[model samples]
Target: MLDYHIHTTLCGHASGSMEEYIEFALTQPLREIGFSDHLPMIKWAHPEYAMPFEKLLEYVQRVLALRQTYPQLPIKLGIEADYYSPAEEAATRSLLAQHPFDYVYGSVHFVEDWAIDDPHNLDQWERVGVDTVYELYFAQLQKAARSGLFDIVTHTDLPKKFGHRPTKDFSALIETTIRSYKDAGMVVEINTSGLRKPVKEMYPAIEILKLLKKYEIPLVFGSDAHAPDQVGRDFAQARQMAQACGFTEIAVFEQRKIVDTYPL
Candidate 1:
């Protein structure tokens, strides 16, 4: 199996040490396991995601060092970077340039200057309507794809995590975003974490999956695991979902290269 979006304890909210995650990955016969922990913020403003900026290099070194002991399996050192626009792009690029990541999974955890979980501002999104939320979401996606730094885009339809089910227009914009990523030769991950969340739907739900198939965008599987047991979880069901969407091969990355493709 290919699991390219595993997180470790370096990020405060996640559980399990790197060794524990690697051990679990090995037991599951994962051909490639990517350490895609959240990226440190450019200004240390976001507390909900990432470890301290000072610890980033050390974490990268540790993940790289682990590859020597587990040479039998490919362990990729990567980062799931938060996508910001030109305003903070300089700092973001500087941060990314510091590490030789195997792959960069660009993500947008915040929408319209606020992270979804912000205690005081969430209810305002409901008033904005799911359609407008979707417009902003896909616009950010296009920005992310054109950023020229990310290798893959994680959880393409993450805005739904706030409890707004998407409609036809939303799905269309998402299809356009996915097609842009595919044209740019960037991989799109199908994260299974949504199933465990209140949203109860995978990123880019089944309808979007069909659009991805039409675009011929390569697929990748990620549990978005933050704990030991979460590693490789739901991959079986993820495979079933991929099969139902007509995907026969799921892409895998290692040492910054597209090394293998696993069959569903």
Candidate 2:
């Protein structure tokens, strides 16, 4: 098994060091583990949530050094980047180009100024209709995929973090989101973190996974672990869900490319 979305303490909200995560992966039956800490935001600075911009180099060098120290374990350095809007595309591209990341996971944690996925903003969900929120989120996700700035889309259905569901069926929206990913030639991560969230289910829900399979979009597994013990957590269940969705292979990346794959 491979976990391509592991985070370290460098991402302020997470605990444990990169080495600690590697040590934990060694205890699991994992073939590869990628360190994908939160990328420093160019427009925002939340030290409590992510590393400062100045620490980017240190974070990369630390992961590179670990690769040498743990030659037996396949460790890939990756980043979880937030996609805000087209206005910031150039800056986002420039920042990402400066680093030689194995993969960049694009995500949308906000819709305009609202932090829809933030726990502190859960009350805001009650102020707006669930369908409206879903529309904004999927729109942002589509834009992120078309931005051509990511190898994988992390936590595809993250807006449901607080378990809010649209009164109307999201079949069309789900299909459109999957189509956007397919059009971009990008992979989607079945992030296991949702299992620990209020939603209590893997991200890119089963229905969405079925649509992804129907479109033949490649899938990848990510624990989205913020701690050592969380590495590879619930991966078996994630894999089982993928298999049920008719996926037999999961993607692996190197130098920002899908270099290989492993069977589910």
Candidate 3:
């Protein structure tokens, strides 16, 4: 098993230290583990959602230091960066250029400057209606995949995690967006985090997995873990799900490149 998306205390919302998460993963049968805590925002606008730039550097330094002690473990340093507008993206890239990360998972955690976790938007189904939200969400995802700074696209159908059923049009939009990512040589992550929330299905659902197979696009696995216990969470079932959808191998990244594959 390979878990590519993970978080630690530096992110504010997540708990546990980097050493704790690595120690827990050492007990599992995982081949690789990556710590991809949320990236720092340029304006420090969302302190509750991500770590600040100064702390982020400190966190990276701490993780890099571990390379000496855990030489046998293939620990990767990475980031899960949220996409905003073009200006924000440029600033984010400028900030990221200062450090070295094994991979970057492009994610859209907001829509028009609003976080998905906003209490007012929690009732997205009742507000925007499921169909409209799904359509808009995938459109943003298409924009995110084309951002050109990320190694993998995280949770392609993330809006579906809020208990919304995508309409036919919405699904088609997702297929088109994913195809674009494939053309760009970026992988999609089957994030298992949704399973821990109210949304029982994986991020993209089984149909999306089949579409990935059809498009011959590579797939990767991420626990999207917020704590130590969540590392490699539900990876067994996720691998089975991907295999059933005809995926023989799941991709992994290092130094912002696809470096390995794990067989299902």
Candidate 4:
């Protein structure tokens, strides 16, 4: 199996060297792995949330060197780029074109200036209202999928990270969100990190998974690991969850495109 959403020390919030994360993956039953540390903050510069602008080359160099260090393992180069407003699309694309990224994960951690997933911003929920936060969060996600700036969409339905649920019915919004992914030929990551969060569930929850299976959008497994031991953190349950949702294969990407797929 493969775990594609691993992070590196370059992203200030994550710990461990790139080598440590890879070494731990080797100990698991993993055949392939990828480093998708948070891309440098664009339109905003937050040192604690992502790597600094100057470290982009450093991040790329380190991951490429690992291929030479461990020729036996298939290590992929990737980045988890946050999805900002549509106005910032051009700037984001210009930054992403600087390197040969195997895959780019389009993620939505912020709704406006406040990060919905950050513990420090928990009070923002009260200010913005939980229901409105959910609506705005999914809207930003739909825009990200349609922008065609990324290969895989990471951690769909992320507002529930702190156990806050929407008071309104968002079935139509959810279906439309998945449709944006389908229309753009995007892959959705079945992120296992949610299980570690207070929600105690996977990202894109079971209901979203069924829609993914129904819509025939491809799948990829991600631990969204911040440290070494988090690699393949909950595969036994994640794979079982995927099979139950009718997913038989997971995608493998290269140079920002899917090269092939691995059986689930």
Candidate 5:
């Protein structure tokens, strides 16, 4: 198994060092592990959300050192970047170009200015209405896919973070997003963090996964770990889900490209 969405303490909200995660992976049955810490944001500097811009080089150096030390393990350096709008896309691209990441996980954690995924503002879910929030979330996600900035799209249905379901059918929106992802040659990550969150399920829900399978979009697995122990957590379940979704192969990346795959 390969888990590509790991995080380290440099992201502020996570714990442990990059070496600790690699050490933990060495004990697991993982074929590859990637450290995709939150990319430093020029617009959002909240330490809890990502690493400070000044620590960017330090983060890269640390990961590179670990890759050298753990040659036996296929450790990849990656980043989880947020997509806001077209205006910010150029800056985000420039920041990404500064590093040679194995893969970039694009995600939308905010809609406009509201941090919809933050537990501190869970009340916003109700304020925005489930229908409106899902629309905004998918719209931003489509834009992210079209931006050609990410190797994998992380947490496809994160707007349901609070377990609030849209009152109306969103099949069209979901299909459009999946089609856009396929059109852009992006992979989708079945992130397991949702299982540990209020949603209590894997991201990109079963229905969404079915659509991904229908479109033949390559799938990947991410534990979305914030700590050492969470590395590869619930990956067996994620694999089972992928198999059930009709995916026979899962993707692994190197230098921002899917260089190999593992059976589901």
Candidate 6:
């Protein structure tokens, strides 16, 4: 198995060193793990959410150094980039070009200037209304898929992080977004971190996973770990979830492309 959404302390919010994360992965059943710490913030910046733009090169070099230190395990250098909007997509593209990232996760943590996933921005949910929040979220997700700036989409239904459910059916929006992802040749990651959140379920929920399976979109796994101890956390459930979704394989990435796949 591959738990490819690990984060380090440099991301500002996460704790522990990069080596500590790698050491923890060594004890897991994972054949490979990726250090996908949050990339530098842009547009409406969140200093506490992501690493500083100046640490960009340092983060890459640190991951490269770990590959040498832990040659027995394949540790891929990855980044979790935020897709704020299409207007800021060019900045993201330029940032990605600076490194030879194994896989780039395009996630939408913000809708407009409000950080939907942030605890500080929780009130925005009520102000913007639940249905609109979900609607705007899927809109941005569709745009992210069409922007051609990411290899995989992480935490597809992140608006539910605080357990906020929509009143209306979003099947059409979600299906359209899934089609955009398929058309863009993108992979969708079943992030396990959502189980730790108030939602008490994996990202995208089972319904979205079924839609991905229906659209024949590829699947990948991510723990979205913020600390070293959280590496490969709850992977048994993740595997079961993938199996239930009819995903027989999990995609593996290299140099921003799916080079191969492994059993789910």
What lDDT would each prediction earn against the true structure? 0.80, 0.89, 0.80, 0.92, 0.90, 0.90
What residue pairs are clashing in model 6?
Answer: none
Error of 3 at 156 (Å): 1.7
Q: Mind giving the per-residue lDDT tens digits that candidate 1 earns over 11-128? A: 7878888889888888885778888998987744665578787789889999989999889878888899988676777778778888888888998877677665444566767777
TM-score, each model?
0.92, 0.97, 0.93, 0.99, 0.98, 0.98
Q: Candidate 4 local accuracy as lDDT?
A: 0.92
Model 2 alpha-carbon miss at residue 76, Å: 0.2
**Which residues of candidate 1, in runs, are more than 4 Å off?**
117-121, 166-168
The sequence of per-residue lDDT tens digits that candidate 3 reaches over residues 1-264 is: 788888988888888878888888888779888888889876446777888777988878877898777987888888988877666778878877778998888888777556664556676457666677666666777777777878888877777665766655656677788787887788889899889877787887898889888988888889998888888998888988988988899787877888778776
* lDDT top scorer: 4
How does candidate 1 score on lDDT? 0.80
Error of 5 at 11 (Å): 1.1
| Candidate 4: segments with Cα more than 4 A from true spot | none
Over 94-137, each residue of candidate 2 has an lDDT whose tens digit, in order, gives 99999899999998988867778788886678787788889989
Q: Over 4 Å off in model 6, which ranges?
A: none
How far out, in Å, is residue 206 in model 2? 0.8
CA RMSD of each candidate after superposition: 2.0, 1.0, 1.8, 0.7, 1.0, 0.9
For TM-score, the strongest prediction is 4
Write candidate 6's Cα lDDT for 1-264 as tens digits: 999899988888998888888889889999999989899987856779999989989999989998999999999999999888777889889989989999999999888688898888877887999999999999999999899999999999999999999999898989999999999999999899999999889897899999999988998889999988888999899889879889899899999888999988
Clashing pairs in 2: none
